[model samples]
Target: MPRERVIFLVDVQSFFASIEKTADRSLQHKPIVVAGDPERRSGVILAACPLAKQWGIETAEALWEAQQKCPGVTVVKPHMQKYIEISVQLTAIMESFSDLVEPYSIDEQFIDLTPTLHLFGGSPYQAARLLQHKIQQEIGVYARIGIGPNKVLAKMACDNFAKKNKEGIAHISYDTLPATLWPLPVRSLFGVGSRMSRHLERMGIRTIGQLAQTPVERLRKKWGINGERLWLTANGIDESPVSPRSHDEQKAIGHHMTLPRDYETLEQIKVILLELSEEVGRRARRKGYVGDTVSVGVRGARFDLPTGFHRQTKLTEKTNDGLDVFKAAFDLFCTHWDGEPIRSAGVALSGLEPDHCRQLSLFNFETTLKKERLSKAVDHIKNKYGAAAILRAASLTAAGQARDRAQKIGGHYK
Candidate 1:
């Protein structure tokens, strides 16, 4: 039997800038480009308010380009601490409606409203509308919400309803999906990215209806398991649930980054590693967790196409300390250097458990004490002031850009 489920996909509008304007009334209705300084040519454009978008500025655009397009744009560096504080509060608010709120990302979440609609004393439509009003009124950020029988459908509905106005809510069911959804382009479905869209276009499948009608075996032959999944999505047949648990369960924690420039020198690479270590360590401490494994990834410079080293490593013990993670990460980098010019690198920590889960190693015991105290101090400063209150030297450049761009500094190092 199909269990009744109503997933609420809530997406904050112009998240970073919106939050900033929400906090300070003075910035409202002003052209706001949250990003780094145009001088350094550093930092990606993170978010833009409606006014900035009108000037052709957008997230991930170069700050210089944004300035050229919109001379009056105001760049504001990110406030990671503020975003987190607001996220915590918003999550609490969402939880009040149901215990099954799953944060899909920093700016969005999925909620299971199946069981609680009756208690709210109305139809799901009424409940959803009320929820939207509550979030906008309480959080000071307008959000687009979609309701459907499953998570994926709800997500699509949210995207469909996210047009110019707060026509802000959409509900989709299998019975009405053909008219409401199938008319949209194939790209409207979740799994179809640029590459997939090109492939589908080649096959004369330009619409969701065409993709849905394609034979499953034909899809599997071309795109493997993902093709079959795509076919299902085209038919409005998403069975995924609005899980309270995150997808992070099987893995503890991991981080990856793309470099703006390639590096050949060991010193330059070491600086990058130190920055990554600081991130892994901070997240571990924030969650009261530690990991027994530390792994690093490298991508070689690609003149023709992007490429490089990708590898992992096991550690001697679990640790939440940046120094230890950095040491292990550096050791792996040296092992894999192969005299190649590195383009990008990343670090990850797995085998996580609560800090008190295991005993410290004899070699690590003494050093762990010092690391703990230092980490706590850093965390306190970051928690109170902002993520920039403490950072490794390598991060200063990016942090400065973040300040200019108006991103939440210290975003989960995804």
Candidate 2:
């Protein structure tokens, strides 16, 4: 018979805020939050420390709202690069404990400790405590640990039990699921969001225990495979492995940005579109992939009324060139744009394949070759010097966002 698997999901507490506090000792005891600048249309709370949480400051709330909630709260701008570096260090720490380590997100990771638990006194709780201590000593961050036989249970144990507990560690098993997890509301389950929870409640499945008891056939009929998956999750069954390469496969590559203010003219909106397309193309080239499908998405400034469209077009040839991507995206925007003031725009590429060779056009063979060579040279220069080392003349115009975007990671200042 095979032995049970031991998986742990570790989450850093107030990740961004914690890092800021660790860097500056003076802010250790004060209520602090990491937020984006208000003038940039990114004035949202990204992370809040425990002290800040006491005043009901929550992530995703506007920075102004958080200040109103806690008048003395200290707001800090996010440093995405620093946070990413610390995440890499945390990954290295986990790799020392187990060979199977998977980063679930910037602040959460899963490590399979089944084989290495014996080295840590054969106690999952004690092993968690030691791991927590090591992270606290080396990185100065508190990590909550959830131990279970599968990833779902581990995640639940961490989010629902461990995070609320004083010891910062919790465990769940098949035998204890009835008492530990079933009493919780169905919405509290891992994948059950507000809509799913409402649906489950309407079906008289208000608690995790009720959802678990519902017949699989009924759920399968309602949501197809997703419903069955949710039922399995409620029953504490997950077979997905903690693979490190889970994020390597790419179905699509896209970049989206929220503008600082409304862009009313076609010329201004097209500039942002070209910049996004260029970014998407650059990423595809870096990954050595060529895509034949281009998509454009636009959202209007007015939230009260519906005014946006997402459209895609297929090209005759696959390419990783920024100019080619921009041309395709520009065509899509011209066709679908409704002349409304756009507040956000995005570009994406799909239908991808390896860029091992290019299909040379019969009429434009020389031109294609020259463009490819030029792109290669530009990529080389940008890589060696910096992304801003070379730029299109349009990028320097008032309508362009490349210069400002270059200083940020994921729409936040780095």
Candidate achieving the largest lDDT? 2
lDDT tens digits by residue: candidate 1, 263-327: 77887788778777777888888877899788898888867765567667788788888888999
Ten residues in a row with the worst lDDT in model 2?
352-361
Q: Please give the lDDT score for candidate 2.
A: 0.92
lDDT of 2 by residue, 305-394 (tens): 879999999999888888899999999899988899998899999998878876666887787678878988988998897777888888
> What C-alpha lDDT values do all the predictions have?
0.78, 0.92
TM of each candidate vs. truth:
0.78, 0.89
Off by over 4 Å in 2: 115-122, 194-206, 221-224, 264-266, 301-306, 338-341, 356-373
The alpha-carbon lDDT assigned to residue 285 of candidate 1 equals 83
User: What's the number of clashes in each of the models?
Assistant: 17, 0
Residue 340's lDDT within candidate 1 is: 65
Candidate 2 TM-score to native: 0.89
